[model samples]
Structure formats: C-alpha cells, structure tokens
Target chain A: MPVTAVLHTETRVVRRLTTDFPALIAPDETAVDVTGLDINLSGGFTVLELDNSLRPASPEEALESGVDEAAAGARRKTRHRAASVALGAAAADPLSHTSLREALTKLRLAMYGE
Target chain B: MGLSVKTGSFVTETATGSKAYTGLGFQPKVLLLWSVGGVTAGTFRTGAYTSVGFGTDSTHRAALGWSSQNGQNFSNCARTQGPNVLDLVQWDVTTHIRADLVSMDSDGFTLNYTTVNATAKIVHYLAIGGSDITSCTVLDWPCGVATGNKVVTGVGFQPDAVMHLSIGEPSSGSSLQADARLSFGMMEAGGGQWSNVIYSVDNSGTSDSQRHQQTGKCIQKLTTTPSVNMAAQFVSMDSDGFTVNFTSVTGVAERVFSLCLKGGSHSLGSFSAITSGGPAQDSPSLGLAPLTYLLSSFNSSGQASPIGSTRWSLGGSDGTSEETAWANDTDALGTSASDTLSKTDKAIVICSATPAVLGEADHSALGSDVFTLTWSTVPVTAHELLYWAIGAGAAPAARIPRWLPVMRTHDPRPLDAVA
Candidate 1:
C-alpha cells in the first residue's frame, strides 16, 4: 500500500441505494449521510460510485456484470479465472469462524460505548 | 536484478565516515540517511552491516526520529512540529535493518556517527541493495515548502529510484549556500543526474557548476529501485504517479524537500560518475511496500542537538508473509467517510491490528485518514491527492478498496451513539 497509500478517489458520488445503507462509518461528530439513510439493502437497490478500479481482478465491467458465466473472455482473460473464483469463495467459507466472531462483537459494541 | 539504488555523501570530520568505490559495481540491500543539519548530537547506531541495518526497530534510532535539526527542517518539513513521530516512519525498517549489513563486501554499506561533540557536518546518503529488490517504498516525508514552478507528486509506486532535496530557510533571507541542494536520482549515468548536496549546507563544488544534470532525469511507475545503468529521466517509468517540476534555486521564501525511490525494473541499475552525488554502485529497494513516512526532528547550525534517520526499512519477520501480504491490505482508497483524509500520516501499521490478520503481509496496509475524503478534486499530480482507501462494509467498494470499517478507525473507546 506504499502506492502512496492508494486513496485517489476525487469527488464522484454517483449514488443509487433504494432503501437504507448508511452506517458506512461515522465520527468527526457522527458523519454518515448515505443521502441521510433511512434504511434498505438486502442487495436490491445498490448503485453507489467512487471508482479507481478495484483490481482484485473483476471489472471488465465487473466481468460484464457480476461474473456472468465468467463473461466469455477478455480482461486479461478473466484475470486468472477471477482470481480463482475470488479465492475459491474466500477459501470455502464455513461461516468463516462465526462470521469472524460476529464481526468482532459488532466491533466491540460500536467501539466501546458500553 | 530488481531493486538497487546508490548515492553517497560524507562529512563528519571529528566523528565518523565511509564511501567511494572508485569503480564500486554492485551489492547493497538498503540504506537511506539524511541529516542536512549538523547531526546536532548523540544517537544513530549500527554501522558495519554485512546485511544492512541502521535505523528503525521502532523509533529513537534513525538519530532521534530523523532530524534536519529537530524541525528547523526535515526534507523541508517541520509541520508545526512536536512528536508526531510519523508512526516511527517505517516499512523500510523491518524493525531496524541489519540482515548482516546488507552486502558490505563490495557495494557500500557502513555508516557510524555517535558523538564527539557532534558538529562535523554534511550527511546525505542513499544506498540501496539488490538480489532482485522484489518490492520497495521510500518517500522520506516533508511535502511542503513551495513556490515558483512547483509540481512534486511522486510516491505512489512505480519508481526505479528518485531523490530530490531543496532546502533553504536555514539562514533567513537565503543568499546562497553552494547550490542550495537540489538532488535527483535513478541513474546508471548519462540519463539521470541532477546534483547539489549538503556540501556543508549546499555547495555544487562551490557554486552549482555541474554536479550532474544529464538532462535532469526524474523517476516513475513510480517506484522500483535497483541500479546498474538506470540513466534516468524515465518519464513514465511505469506511472502510477509522477510529476516533479520543482523550481527552488531561491524561488522565493524558499523551503522544499522531496525524496522519491522506486528502484529496479532492471535493464540497468548501477553506475555513477557524471557527478553530483557521484560514485554510486547500486542496490536497495527490498520486498515492496511500507513507506508511509512522516517522522522528523532537527537541530545543528546552532545547537540543541538532533541528528538523522531514514526508514521504511522494508519487511522481514512474518506472522504470515508476502511481507505480511503487503502489510495487510493497504486500503489506500475505498471512498467515503465524509470523503476520507483523516488518517493523518502516522504511516506505520505492520500486521494491521487484525482483520483475521489482513492480507498476511507483503507490506503496507495503512489508510483511514485524509479528511472528509475531499482532496478538493484531484490532480496536483494526484497520488490520491495525499491519501485514500475506504471500503470494509458499508460501501466505497473499489478504487483500491479492501476493508476497514471499525467505526472507520481505531477505538481507544468512546463511540456508539449513532444507534
């Protein structure tokens, strides 16, 4: 990450959430604003934008729209088979350790407020 | 082979020294020290490295957090000064380099300056090593002191070695102190050269005659380090970021400091003698990533005593290893958290506290600072404007995204009010 710590995402908010997704993270006096989130996202309406290229080898337009049948070639030939099916579905996740200890106990109860 | 960079400078008189091969050739794994001040007083250990070790086992070593004098100037940086320590400035200091002193048989490596009243003067060295550098990062902090034709946007990866130091303001009105230091590297000769060291405080032999300015070659890809015949001005070198116009020959109110090194793509990574910082042999840009840099401390033209240090000591001591998967996911850009930039250059992170161990270590996994993530809007050369990366759960999904959503950062404990 010495690639100058990688954050080159200059002003490009192309939103499209549908219901409510906020809580991406907050502080600096609780700063959230996913268009002031109301709440929604089982994976229905999701189109947010901030791009610079995720480079974990997706994107030939996310392999022509979310890995469509490995999208018939191109993009350095499906980037080594989408980095081997996204690292074999994250090493065949078996609920990866109780979803990582319940996301570190909801991140230690939202970072120790209790 | 891959990353090898070399350059030399010596001036201590009463304390210590070393350098000059007559023909040098190759072998050195890493070394970067810059004093410019006078090395005010005590501190700066390890000299005879057959493996290459000088500073960074976690601060207090690189001669009191890398001094130009304590902040009279550091690469041209003082930034209000006080012990920010820039996360002990590392990635280049896998805990204070000393693998055996990284190739001492031939290509340079051995610097010792402890104390004798500390005021001999002149210290500017950059000696890298190569077995095939594999991966590297060295930016040496201090990013402001501008005016005239300013550009500087290096350090975003893709360098084969680049260095620049424009220090002025140690004496107020700035008349002339030799050439007033303006160095550039990435040379095998003929192609890259632009010199002017701390020849006491700046002296191109007396007055910037022609130290070495082949065409004043810069660097790029922006980071690669290794050196045989680099002979650079590389232009794009690889271009993840590059732009350094610089115009401080007394451009006005003068104060500048730039050091960029990304050594080795190798076609040539050794050779020196066009002048300036001359006689280099090349090597040092080891195992890629971790130069988040920002540490400083200076003192000496008068006395208060503060010395030198250059870290990013670059990897080795794995819990998992690719250097710890590039130091665990270096998120650099994930986007959103008011827009980003508040990760405040503390720079060093190592195993990333934990995300099940993050990336497993290759080098670099720092991010989460830069404020509202705004950057006013890109292109000042754009190395992510100055820092980025914000994806872990809620969004920002990509642009360098990886993950880091623990209420955005740390938890000394006091959050949880948002329901």
Candidate 2:
C-alpha cells in the first residue's frame, strides 16, 4: 500500500514502514507479518497514519515522492538562474545589439505584467 | 534458550484508550523503557526518565519508573505502581495523565493510560526474550536505616545485572529544601559498575545549586548544605540477590528501587586509563562475542572541579550504530546538564553516533569478546578515565574436562601414544 499522509505529532514524526532500515531506526507502528521470513518489526520502521492502512509504502512511491520534491526545487532554481543570466547579458552589451534589446523587452513582458 | 533483544520506539495514544505494541516475534520476559525527548504539545516536563518491568502476565509483574527535571532546580518524581510513562507537565504522580503497562501478551505488550487528553511523547524500549530469564524482580531499600552491610535476598537466582533508581519527588520551591536526588546506575556480573547521580538544593526557589556526582556507588546521597551525607554502595553480586552497605546513620528515608536481571550471557568489568586522544585500543576481553554493549565512563578522582562526570555510549557492529549521553557539573558554575553537546569535550567519549559531534572519543565493538575505543580529541586538562562495560550475547558452552586413561604396565603403551 502507498503512504498518503505523514503524521506529524508533538512527540515524533511518522512516515511509512519499509523493509530496508537505516542504522538508527525511529520506532513506528507495531506488528509485522512473519509468514515466510524470520524477520519481525524489531528491524525498526516509521508509522504511517491512515484511516485503515496496514501495508507498507512501496519503493516506487517513495522514489517518486523524493524525486518530485528534488526536481521541483531544481526547476525553481533553474528559472531564477535563467532570468539572472538574461539580465546580466543585457546589462553587459545592451547598446550594441538589437537582438539583445528585443530579448530584454520580451523578458520584461514575461517577468512583469505589461 | 538463547537471548534475543529488540529496540524500538512508539508514541503514546492521545485519546483515552489503551494500545498494544506487537511485532516482537517472541514474548519478552523483561522490558526496559525510557523517555526519549521530543517536541510535544502542552507544558511537558523536559528531562530524562526510565522504567523497567518484568513478567509474563499483568498481575505478576513488577515495575519502577522515575523522571528527573533539570529546570529551576532538579526535581525528581518516582512511582512504584507498574511502568508508567508520564506526559509533560506531570511532575506530580498523583495526576491521572500517564501511561502504564497493563499486560505482557504473547507477542508484544499493552499499555493503559489514565486519560486520553494527556500530551504524548516518544518512548524507547528494549525488550529481552528467552527461557534463560528465570528471574526478573524489583527490590526496595530504605536509605540511611543503619550503618552496615545488608544482604538483599529472595531473587531466587543470582542476577546477571541490576539497575538502581532513587524514588521520591524532591522539588525546589518556596522553601530551602534538600530532598531531590536522582541517580541511575547499572551493574553487570563480572563487569564494572557505573552510575550518575544529580543532587540539587532549592533555596527559597530563587537560588539553586546542583551537584552532579559520578561515583562507583549506584545510589549515593551526599551534600554539604543542611549537612546530609549518605551513600548506598553496591557491595557484591551474591548467590541470591545482592548486598548494599549504607555509610550513614541518619538522613531522609529516601527509598531506592532496584530491578534485578538474572540469566542471559552478560560480561561486566571496568578498566582504567588516562586520556591522551589516542588510537582505538581493545578493552579487556569479555571472553565471549557480544552483539551489543553499553560503555560508561567517569573520572577516577571522584568529585572535583568537573565534579564527578559520567559519560556513556551504546554501540554495536563496526561501531557504526552508537548512542551517547553524558552529565557533568562545572563546579565554578554549579550547573549541570545531560545530553548537552557543548560540555562533552571536557569529558572523554567512548562511542557516539556522530563522533564529530562529541569530539572526544569513539568506540566500536570487535568481532571477538573485546571492543576498541579511541579518543578523538585530547582533554584540555587530562584526567583518569574509568570505563565500565556490559556486553550481552549468547551463553557459551560449559567446559568439559579431558581425562587421561590409566595404562596397564603389561600393555607397554608409550606415554606419547596414550589416547
């Protein structure tokens, strides 16, 4: 099952339980199925707050959420860097180039309202 | 049966209700729980607290819990009723806002709370499971009763280890009071004893002073103001329970709670060395491989300028997983703090999750029965370090003697050829 919401309580932060664990595992919800393997919940896990969810969060969901947050931050930084580069180029050789002047006008229109 | 130990954490339920924590493959015979500090709603008391319970069922178990608050003055409260995990703002045990272990079930355990409206906090627990756990009991001793050795029996079996905690709510309020003393000590058979005690005096609730004493004695009460001197020294681990000698004749009837653990493969001992910020050195052998171990250190000089410092770490494997906490009082300031990173450099650290964070020492257990410790940074003022270790693992097989068979003279068997 996929984890929907991370429960942030006053005491601890809870996400979803996963098979793999880091060296220091924060305690989580109890009871793990021990059908085929000898491992138990003692390996350490995170708690996922659900109305009735029991299964753990899948790998794909974890990866997708991690990548989504990283990519979103990168995209925002990239746009800010592009705007700074354009402004720098116009300031350097604005009087000599007609293309640069036209580009600055378009850039200004995109950045500002009118 | 062999021993199995598991560590985990959980958050107490907020609403009025009970919760059972499962997933422990086997039923635990003994459970040790502590309050791991975290952000919480409402005015929660911030400090350290611990509780230990032993039993297979609810009615037959025994538990003792105590908490220490290092605020205006060091205030401590203890309860003898099952293992109760108190919420924040609960310095008084009379309040119904607490979590108590109700029963030890087949898989995990259950906790019943007084009210659901109390603030929740993170609790870390270590549970031990095995048939070798023959006896898990608690003993209470009235301090300053007499000035002689008192043997504590009725444990049924010699305990492998014991934990001591002083019970009573000693506070700092309107009057100049001198009752609050919080001490935590653990000792393992064949190993060393380590304990940290903090004694504070509330003078008119305005001016307060705390004495952080690190001594071999698990339960010690010594103060200059109001002239109170007493120490409950752990004499030895005996055939049944143990023995404690009281060194004072008169003092408050402060009670001491002890949790005795018998069974399992445990090695307990202490070593002494000077701090020079050196390489990793192997500790004296424990004679058997250990899966996990706890290391504790204190100044050998007893109480002084850095009045009795106590530092300890829990470590496992290539020393990668480790947790360290320390409490020390700088006599000049008359202030003491535990789990604080700034004052760690003054003392030596054996092992830490973040070695750089402590910047004193780091420790890792070797594959064999011994572990290695290294001091990352030399102390500004060098002092003797008394390190105590308690290692737990599978019990080793008993040794069998080899006897030489008698050879008849007529047989003419060579001495070297005897089987």
Candidate 3:
C-alpha cells in the first residue's frame, strides 16, 4: 500500500470597539459643517476639530454631558468617541484535506484572543 | 545418513524342466538411485520397486526378475525392471541422484512379510528463453483485425476497434528513432473557394460611405478685434467691416483684424457676418439708425469708456463736447476719416431736391415726346444717383453732384437734346 499526506490550517483575528459621543451645533445654525473634524487612528485613537477653538474630552465625559450645552459658548466645543474595528482570517495549506471543524475552531480562538 | 545393504534372508530355487517348483519367498527391497538428463523430467517417482520370489511360475518369474540387469554387467547394480514388465517401464526418470537405504535384496522360503523403506531427495532446475517482436502504424488510419478463428476474406468481416500493440527492443545495443513532418498550403487564384480561404477584412479602415459632403456657398472668414476705445480708426469706404493688417512684433506678417460700426441709438445692433481675406460684402444690411444713442465700447463687457481710454464715464451729449470731439476728425464728407467716432456725434446727409410725382403733367414735365428729360436749376448735389425714363428711346443717366448751384439752368427738352 502507498500513502499520501496533506496538511491544512487557518488563522483569524477580530477586534471591535464601540462607544457613544456628543455632537454640538450653534443655536442659529442652518447646516453643520463637519468637514473640519479629523479622526486619527494611526496612534491609538484621537479626534480633533481642524479649527483651534474647540476642545477635547474623554469618551465617558462626552456621553455624560450632552453636546448641546457644551457647544453653547462663543468658542463652541464637543466631544466625540470613535471606534476602530477589524476582522480578518487567513489559511495555509488550503488544498490539503483537513478537518474544517478544527480549522474553524482555531480561527475562532485566534479572533477571540483566547 | 549412509547407505548400508543388509541381507535379511536367502533361499535356493531349482527349476526341473518346465516345471521347476521352488517355494521361495523372501522380501527384497532395493533402494534405487536414478540419474536422468535433459529438459523434460519429473520431480518425483510415483510407485515402489521390490525384489522377491514366491514360486518359479511364469507370472512370478517376471516379478522376481524386476531387479535383474538387462545389458551391462556390473559388480553392483541399481534395481532395474525387465522389458516384459510394461507397467513399470513408463515411470519418469530424473537427473542427479542420491539415496539412503535401510533395506537389502533377499530371497525367502516361506518368509513372513517384513517392511523396508528408503528416503531419497530429487532436485529439478529449469531455464527459459524468449525473443521480441516489433510493429507500428500511422495515427488515424483505418485498421482492422480478424474477430473470430475463421480466416477473414473481405473488409466486411473485420470489426472496428482500437488496435493497441507494444514494441520491444530488437537487440541489446540497438536504438529506435521516429520522425514526422506536417505541412499546410493554400492557394487563391481568381478568388478561390471562400470556404477554404480565411479572410479578415477591417472595413473600419475605410471612410464611411454614408457620410455626405456639405453643400453650400463658401463662407468668408471674419477677423475681428474687440476694442474698448470709443475713438478707433476705421476704413469708411468698406461698407462691410474694415480689415486692419498689422505686422506682429514676433515676425508674423499681415495679421488682419476687422472693425465694424454697429448701428442704432444704443449702438447695440451689432451684426457679425462671415468675412473673407479681402473686403467682406455686407449681407442682409442692417439699419444703423436705431444705434445712434448707444455708447460704443471696444470691449465685450462695455465696462470701460470708449473715449479717453479709462474707467466708465458718461459720453458727452453736445457735438462740441470732448466725448463728441470724435466728430471733428470726420472727413470732408462727414464720414469718420479715422476709425474713431464720438459718443454723440453722427454723420448726416441732406438731399438737395425732392423727387418728382408721377402722372402729373405740367410745364416742368415737358411735352408728350416718346422720351423727355426735365432739368432742375438747383446746383448739382454731392451724391451719385441714377434716373430712368419710362418711354421709347429713353435710357437712364447717372448724375454726380459736386456743388449745389454750379450748373446752368435750362428749359425742358427732348431726350435727343439731352443726349
């Protein structure tokens, strides 16, 4: 008898974040100009207005204190919380016969960081 | 491991005439070692050979001589069978022989039965020989072979099937090589068969046959330069727009730009007809009376002043105003000598005489001649005009006026007198 062997495996990762934030508008505002808002996720996460007048606040504080009153002053300001999430899966030796259940189990473990 | 022949018993036999009676019975078991040569041989012997005698009877004598030697005389001889014993003659013999014996030849005189046995081993060797056959056939060729044991006479007897055969090496050092070539040729004489020829014509390379050439009179090219200056030079004789030919500083020769005076009070009624290399003819001549009051500007936006070359300002109304000073530059005929024109200034011409009424006869009409000419004492006007007589022998005459009262007065006369 002759024998042949093949191997297959897969890896997956998923990261998720969710938060609430506050938005502000002037009392006599017609349309909100959000073009100046910059959301940077390159180094951790940070959100800022292109204009110098606004100030930043924590995600918790932004949700606790609403945006309407905080933006009422002359130099209006608001706090917004942003989340960056991703999910990905990769496989090796995919052509080989292997237990799909086992590959999926490994992928799930990798995604959950368990 | 060694062979030892022992005599168990012996007896004497006497034959008296044909009736030799000898009751001799002794077990004679001979261990035979047979050697045979050649290709066809058996691996083992089937039956047993023994030597014994019970009586001198013919049937018993044959059996007793089973151990007798027929031709060669030897001091020690292996057991042999007589020619008359046909049953034992057909036994197979093999090459290479060895034997171990615990029995001996004996003659008995009423002996009880005793058993003797011997062990022998025979070995056989075999060799095989073979030769190879060679065959080949072209691909896709129709071929057949006989289906049954009967000889096939015609093509109909052969059945269709793929013939698969193998080729073997003819000799140990020989090598086989096969070569083949495939070629194709096509000829197209006088448009050969369309089916056999491949055609890839690109009709897109040719111009579309459906396109039609535009039919109309040649249009003249109009060269125009927009201006903001109210006092721009112009050639007045060109009823059409005037063409200004200027040599570019960059060595471009004879670049022409046209300038036309728009008419009406607002100078707003501008007509842009196509112009050619030479003077362009006026097409559908527009009425210039309505554009009199229009402030003419050199630029399309009309934001700058046409006079003094600056910001927008009201064009003066009076004929002597600076804005209207463009009129002072007019020629003797009251047409602008240069291309410039004042804002409020305009050219005016007055006719010296009124045209005569038809069908009213009087002293001025002259008598009822076939062709008559009437003369006006008024001075010759300063304009070109043509007159026609609606009678026999009458022809029109062109009148060029230079002054109002220079010509002599004369009474009505006949057409011949005027001629």
Candidate 4:
C-alpha cells in the first residue's frame, strides 16, 4: 500500500472566448484533482510537466507518432474530442477531477510514476 | 500521461537560429516556446538543469535570452528593468519557462541561442519534467559593448521562481498594428515578489480571438531584488540569477531569461482587490485547494472600464464570453487594458491547494470577485487578478534521468539522478 496521489483543486466560473462584442467571457477558472488515482478522477485537470513527455504529437497522436505531414496533420485541427472541452461545463462534470483527460493522467504520472 | 509532457517542432534556419536545441527529456524545468511573428526580432534559449553537462565539474544550467538588435534596447537578462521601455504588442511569441531538472544522459544539456534571424522562425517547443524538479539554471548572456547593471550569479540552490526575457528591441510596428512587444517576466521566490511583463498579441485575428488574444504586453513589480539587475527588457524575477544594474548598456546586446523553481515554485494563493461597486462580487474566499489561475487587470481594466471576464465592466458590459480553457491551459495576455495595466499582471495557475486554504477540505467553491457588471455603474477600475498556485501537492517522479555511468544508480528505473 505504498501508493499515494491526493491533489485536488477546483475553482470555476468557466466560459471564455473573448474578442469582445458578446464573444463570451466568465474567466476565473482553476482545476486539479486526484483523490487516490486508480482511474477516473472526474474532469477538469490539466497539469503537465515531465518534459511535457517529449512534446510533439496530437493530430491523433501525430498519426500514431509517425507524423505523416500536411504540416504534420496541421497539429490537431480535429480529434481530441470524446469530451474534454477546455472546462466549459467543467468538461462534462463527472464530479470534476479537472479534465484534459486527467491532464493526460498528469502527464503520464509525471513521466511514468504510479 | 501524468505530467512529464513533451512536444517539438523547429524550423529557423539562416545558420542555426542561434543554437542549443536539445532532445528535451530532462534538462527542462518548464520551457514553453511558441511562434507567430510580424514586427520581429531574434535571440532565444530557456533552460533549467543543475548538472547536465557544461564545465564546472560538468552540469549546471538556467537559461533565458532576448535580442532585438539595433542599438540594443539597453537592459536585459530575458529582461529586468524597473524604469521604462515596453509598449509593442504585435503578434505571437509567447514564451514562459520555469527551471530545475538535471541529469541529462551522460553529461548532456544545452539549449542555445545567440541572435540572428528576422525570418524563417518556426518553433513550437513544450518540455515539462518531474520529480518535483530539484535544480536548473539557465543564465545566458550577450551584451557586446556598453555595460552597467546586469548581474547573474551562482544559483546553486534557493529558487522558487524567477523569469525574464529580452532579445534586442526596436520594432513596434508592422501588420494590423496592436502593440508589438517581446519582453516577458513572472515571479515567485520570496517576499516583495511580483513580476510580469507581457504583450501576447492576437488583435482580432479572430480565431476565437486568436485563441485567447495572445497580446497586450505585461508589467508587474514588487521587487526586493535577490540578485537582480536587468533594466527590464521583458521579464524579471529573483533568487540568484542576475543582480543587474546596467542603467545603460548599448551596442545592441541584451538577451536574458533566468528560470529557477525549487520543488514546486508558484506561490501567493489568493488576492482580490476589486472594490468599485460591481453588481457581481465574491472574490474574498480563496484560501487554497483551488488549482489553476493567473490574471492581470492590474490597475483595473483599461478602456474606460474594461474588465469583463466574468464581470467588472459597465462601460458597455457584454457578459458570457463562454469558454473555459485548460485542456492544458497556458496563457500570456496583455493586448489592451491600457497596455497590461502598467504594473500588476501575473498568472501561474497549477493547483491542489495553498495560499492559506482553510478546511472543509480547503474550500474552492470558486468565488472570485464573481461580478456581472455594476460597480457604482462604471468607473473605479483596476480589474484585478494575482493568483499563483501550482500542482497541488507533489507527484511526478518516476522516469527521466536515464544515463547511467553508475554512481548511485538504483537501476529499477524510477529515480536515479546524476548529471
């Protein structure tokens, strides 16, 4: 039982899309949560670190990390949606664990941890 | 996918758009590099690695650089000026770095840049690391002739946060015209600590406000100067990494960006000084546990009452901008608010708790100045914001440090650092 991961933070006012003229704005959002991590944190977190994991892939993982090209699939114009909408309704609110996956699982447990 | 992030892309030729572009596996504490230019300049580098590979018994690094090149905009070290010089906000060039993360393979580390290029620049770097990052010092330098106040010292340890950036100034025009600036700063290392200077441009480029205005130039100060002396080229901070005092150093040569963050590095949890009579107020409750946040309405929103992210605007109030970024949020704003509010604009949100978070699980019911517009009708401004919280508790530290020459090499492949 040497597994520890308890980090939680959730502040919301959500909605943002500024340019003015009713472009939409709520601003004042914050998120992070991990209660015990086995899986399912809730939705609302996005905390990356750990060399961002070597960054460079998100056009569907850059075409499965092969990166065919088209400006590298344009670096993600589509894909990245099952849900996870930048916190709007807190991503969908599964109890809100801070979404973006789980901030990608916290960047892969910060580069492969537990 | 827990935290150690990584993303790469580079294309700036004309003979090495400066230099030092590593694999970014460890030698990074927190480096973000983006590009989209107009009235541009050159010079770049941002690092954090305490013992990665470089003379002095082989490893120690912390970096930041900026070069506008033209009679050299006078002050630098990724910028640190307390006097004047800033007001160009054109478009794209958002860079933010936080350092400390050593052990690079077998003595490997370098993120170089010395100036050269006003064209072919296509960069998109993002390297994040873990293990609560212990150390990294990137104090790069380049000031050809005239000198006076510019200091960067032995950052052996002792650093919670400090950032500054400057390249070579002179180029506040070209394009749809907004406010072209390439100077940046943000801080947190101790008391009197408050530093911000940004102008991320996105003036009605309208791709969702260019995805978040990305412009406005920044300014923030509450300096005590730990060892700083940078006439503010762009950004500034403390905890050993420049004790600058170059009242005037010409011949165009100023490029500095110093980053140092020990453990977590991101202090000051909550602060909401937004009193004016808005029909929407609530910000008097952040004691911690509420992650993510960084704002600047400094001396109230500009443009005759323009602070309406959620409220504090009655000049022509337009609520509900409908959005909530954090699919991995990273922001750099300051396009207009009368130009980043003069001094007082900074946001470094990454949370879990701290800032004096009380109990009941440390409450984060999220109630900051919850306004909608109505502060005595309109005009008592300074649309405030200053929240700095990071991570939450401390987790990431499983891999990265893979370069065994053997010296305490535990080998199960989890934690075995040595540069």
Top candidate when judged by TM-score against the true structure: 2
Q: What number of clashing residue pairs does each candidate have, in the order they appear? A: 123, 12, 28, 147
- lDDT (Cα, tens digit) per residue for candidate 3, span A1-114: 111110000100000011101211112211222333332222221223333223334443333332211122111211100100111122334553467645654654443322
lDDT score at residue B406, model 3, on the 0-100 scale: 25
lDDT of each: 0.23, 0.43, 0.16, 0.27
* Candidate 1 per-residue C-alpha lDDT over B1-419 given as tens digits, one digit per residue, 9 for 90 to 100: 34344444344435433223322256544444443222321122211010111321122111212111111110111111111111111111111111111124464544332222233433433444555443344333332222112333444555544443332222321112211122223321112232211111110011111112222333210100001011113333345434443221111222322333333322111111011211111111211232122111010111111111111111121111111001111111111000001011112111121211111111122224211111111112101001111111211212221111112222222122212
- What TM-score fits each model? 0.24, 0.54, 0.10, 0.23
Candidate 4's residue-wise lDDT over A1-114, tens digit each? 121111111211111111122221122222222113232111222222232211222344323322122332233323222122333344345776666646655543332222
True lDDT of residue B6, candidate 4: 40
Clashes of 3: 28
Model 2's DockQ? 0.01
Q: In model 3, how large is the Cα lDDT of residue A23? A: 15
iRMSD computed for candidate 2: 25.9
Q: What is the TM-score of chain A alone in each candidate?
A: 0.19, 0.28, 0.19, 0.17
lDDT of 2 by residue, B1-419 (tens): 36655555566677766788998777877665544233231112234333333343443343433333343222222233333433322223333245556766678888776654444555545567766676776665555444457687766668877777653322211111122334566665643455555443221122222433344455554332211134555677799888866543222355555778876766544444334434344555555565445544443334432232223322222233343333322221222232322121112343221222323555433446555555555344433333333334434444111111112112123223334
RMSD of each: 26.4, 24.4, 64.3, 25.1
Q: How would you class the docking of model 4?
A: incorrect
TM-score evaluated only on chain B, model 1: 0.27
Native-to-model Cα distance after best TM-score fit, residue B33 in candidate 3, in Å = 99
Q: Is candidate 3 or candidate 4 better by TM-score?
A: 4
Which model, 1 or 2, shows the larger lDDT?
Answer: 2
Supply candidate 1's per-residue lDDT for B267. Answer: 16
